[model samples]
Target: MATSKPQVSPELSKHYSARMVAVFRYGSLAIAGIGFIQAVIFAALGSWVVVAMELSAFVGGLAIYFLIRRGHLAFGILAGQAALMAIAITMGLILDVPTADAPRISHLYLLVLAALGYLNYQRGKSRAQLVLIGLCLLAFIVLASAPLTSPFVVLPDMARTIGTWANAVMATTLLAVCIHAMQAEFNRKDKFSRDLMTALWNDEFQLAYQPQVDLSQNTIGAEALLRWNSPKRGAVSPVEFIPQAEELGLMVAIGGWVLEQGCRTLAEWSKNPLFRHLSLSINVSASQLMHRDFEAFVRDTLVKTRANPHRLILELTESVLVTDIDLVIAKLDGLRELGITIALDDFGTGYSSLSYLRRLPIQQVKIDRSFVQDAVNSSVSASLVKNVVLMSRDLGHTVLAEGVETIEQHALLARFGCIEFQGYFYGKPMALADFEQRIEARIKRLA
Candidate 1:
């Protein structure tokens, strides 16, 4: 709400305008329906003036609906309706009907106006502040004049009878509109979540391999990245759907799938002697790493796929490892004892990547692309990266500099003692087949 762009808010707030229109339309229908019911009650009691007022409310609500639908008078309609309600309550107070009824009606109207004002403020619609001020002033005037007015003012405040009904109708309308908006939002998210679930089952997610070339060792390795091709959503990013998968209790299953796919790719590559020594790395989420059967999953997948566990690498971000250092260390040790390697992905971006680097059983550290991409242009980034590369190499760990998109970055990192590199300078992530062809060609050229 503080930001100028309301459309950029939460999922529900992004649809605030549409929700407001719905509220107006639904509120209008509610007002008309309640007004008609009031009219019938007054007709039985022979109260013509009260009937007229109720009928007026119904017409006003109808007019507001049309105004909003036409994209005209949106601001005026919301402000005018609140103003009119306040005026009606003020009139009721002036007419000294009964201490019990007039004041209660006035207070009820004030509360309803406040509710509308708060919603308007959150929505940040046009003229909401002015409208709130006007409503507040109206309430003050009604309360202030309640004592000074003459004993008999007008038609004995017939609104007391009608006010109760109108208040109830408006309250119910507001409540229903909010509930409807929330339900609509959930339904929208549920659709995508369902698509993701179905996609997981239908084999819609695939892996892309980015080579992590260890220049000093003259060896090739790769990091496996997940890509989702949803039939409904079309190329949904991991940023958008992976968290949803995690929240839906599907990460363990999805993570297992990734592990198997990466190992299967490794198995295929093993046929080509040039690619046999390459480390095939796949990312592991915190949830997956902490999973009770994660180690077993890795062992079983490697056995079934006939993929060499010695050549398999499991990558975890710095923050993921810091969740519980002991658990991470134990897990990494167990996997390493099986001849599998553990990598610290996106290092230097986390608060304590360095602090825990020595503590964890990590074999390699990948300097985050953010540091490399900006290092050429930013002195601070370059300094941080230099320290990281130097410190990591000194620790006897395989240091990889990722996102080395230029000859200069690759040359600079190699000079900085970073033995490994991955980025556009070498090659982007590619399908297993494409990468195999590239490896074969590079090997042939060198021979």
Candidate 2:
């Protein structure tokens, strides 16, 4: 792979990072603030020791926040908080912070702190951070329970009875709060992810076609391309987002949608006898091919749009062939049986390029743009294209040279026995309606 310079603006990247930090800091502060308020209320109700413990926790949290802000905090912040919690519990026991009337509140505070520590640990992105947080939470839980598990049971006194009831209430409240917090976080993250996808779907992602003309007739034969649009970002280039969508598991849906749209457009165009000979080609992502229901989806879309399967060409990248040679060949064969022509896109871009020619059920080879762009200036590139074209011809596959941006380049390709060409020299991509008008005008002029 070619190593390219970073494409994102440095300022934008920095701003994004800063925003994430702010969210993390504010989220932590909010949790601490709630704990502090609860402690104050409990203290006012005559549970001074519990209030003191809560205050200590609040102070510890603030210290952690500062350390994080300064970029000096280690993963040990969780451990440190757990230690402070332990110390608070010990002091409470020594002075009897929870009276006979409210032993339950003290237990609730300890349990809630432990739960918070556990959540902090689980939220850490790295394994090291997670382990540190887990240990801290564990320590807090152990320390908080040490006194309560003492061998000597307090006599069945009023103070003991009140403490037991308070502890029960505190446990119930803590459990409820933790459950609500977790549910809210899950819902928030889910909504954010869904919104991001929706925005991407509506954005300026679009398909551009390279006309595949027949060498014998010198007329436009077909248009092969895919569409992608993003709302926030304008025109996310396929070369940039295709791989990302595959990695992020969004390609199947996107690719299927593109297929349906392309087929429907082709069916609409086919109504004109002038365009009857012009085929439509759509690129399929590896993720889409790997889906168990892909073939069925393609069949259903073709039926729904009433598009001729023979006129719909499906293009697959060489990367897909490389994934599992036998599987790809089998899948291509299935598509071929449905009368859908298969083209190997970006033919020479991957490893084992020559191997795919013999193994896959490909009917056409679209020479990658890189070779076409360099063919005019470099003999090596020219020779590579010549060999690929010759090889495809020998295998009874049609060859289409992509990115033919100059007349000289077009002339050179023609000299090398290359037939079909598509690039900016003819015309950049236009809207479907504009393209149709151009086609009509060209036909009229020729007539």
Candidate 3:
């Protein structure tokens, strides 16, 4: 499945950009070393100034390495490189340095300096770095054109000087091309991610209602679970994408859609008397609950869908209760006052499971699949399940064991007085039509 575009925070984006710049800085330094070697060989059998300049560039690169290793700002390293280039320009002006036949050599140095300055500008927050980059560019321009205008006999021939100018222009063009390409690729990936998310939001996803049964009544009470029916990838599980959606701040919208869809399904089911009494539960994530208007959202959805609030159960994980216990209690109490039932989902999975049960005004505890899966074989898991079910019962909360696939597991749970059960043994998650039919068949059998 095509992944949704991740919504990275500004601080995180800057951190990622800094890391990328660090890698690029090292790569550029290596390339600069190669260029310096060529410059040294070309100017050999001649001036000592070329050797000194090459040594200066090497030393400057070492300083940049230490700065990066020490966790200093990457832009600071680029700024230091610009300063070294300025020093080189000053030395060339004072010494009247000899330039080899390769005029491109001088232009290459100017281009590298300009690139470092521009990158520093990109990574900088304050205007100082930008201003520094502008100064560096201006200096490079003067240094590059000096051979053409001055009595400094660096490049004595006009052809050599013209070649130098051409090389500088070419290098500048290449840098621009690289910048443009990076920006284009970033934009393209960003747009693709946005489009993928939009599609997911626009009902490209499907909903599956898993039957949560009341073991006492042998009747199915459905819980609406989200299933993404991607056009390209078939079915995408909520376990995979919901966390990403929450991180991107898209969970509220997606949760709203699920609420509406679930209520609508309940209203439709209510038409059949046999299915009318089946309570439909929907899982609400912590992010959805954190919204200030969440209580109103739920109330409004019930009113709009004409579904009975009492029959609409909102399943919340224990993690939500622990994060902000007072807030959760306040919100849940308000929900209960509205006659909306709340179920504490995946009950024993959290850190402070027992403490949360006492604090939150919850009506039911859906024992997590982990304990239920192991209850048939493992004594430890069975003991844990028995304790949870007994505690919940003593506390006057309904306990439901999930993932009961075997008759033995079902019989074991029944022995422990777990009044509610749900899993593949009763029935796999089915479409709305199939579920209604199953409800009818089960009702007839009971009758």
Q: What's the count of clashing pairs in each model shown?
A: 0, 16, 0
By lDDT: ranked, best first: 1, 3, 2
Q: Candidate 2 residues 1-447, lDDT tens each?
A: 110112333222221223334544554464467548756666666666556756766776666666556654333345445555564455445533343353423434455554554544434334554554455456446545554433222323444465456545654665566556666655744554464467556644455554556553344655645544545445544444554455457778777777877788789878998777788777787778978899889888988999889888888876785577788888888899989999877778676456668887889888877889899999999999889888889999988887777888888888877888766667666667767777788789889
Higher TM-score: candidate 1 or 2?
A: 1
What order do you get sorting by TM-score, best first?
A: 1, 3, 2
lDDT assessment of candidate 3: 0.67
lDDT leader: 1
- Between prediction 1 and prediction 3, which has the larger TM-score? 1
Please give the RMSD to the true structure for each candidate, in Å. 11.9, 12.9, 12.3
Q: Which candidate has the highest TM-score of all?
A: 1
Candidate 1: the clashing residue pairs are: none
Query: Mind giving the per-residue lDDT tens digits that candidate 3 earns over 1-447?
Result: 111112332223233344345555564465356436634653663545545655666666666665655556454455565666665465446433335544423434555555555655444354665665666667667765666333444533653564356545645654665465457546744553574587655778666666777665466588777767777656654544565566567788888888999888888768877778888888888888878999999889888998888788898876685477788789899999989888988777676467677777889988977788899899999999999989998888998888778889888998898988888887777777887788788778888
Worst 10 residues of 3 by lDDT: 1-10
lDDT for 40 in candidate 2 is: 69
Q: What TM-scores do the predictions have?
A: 0.62, 0.56, 0.58
Q: In model 1, what is the error at residue 11, expressed in angstroms?
A: 13
Winner of 2 and 3 under TM-score = 3
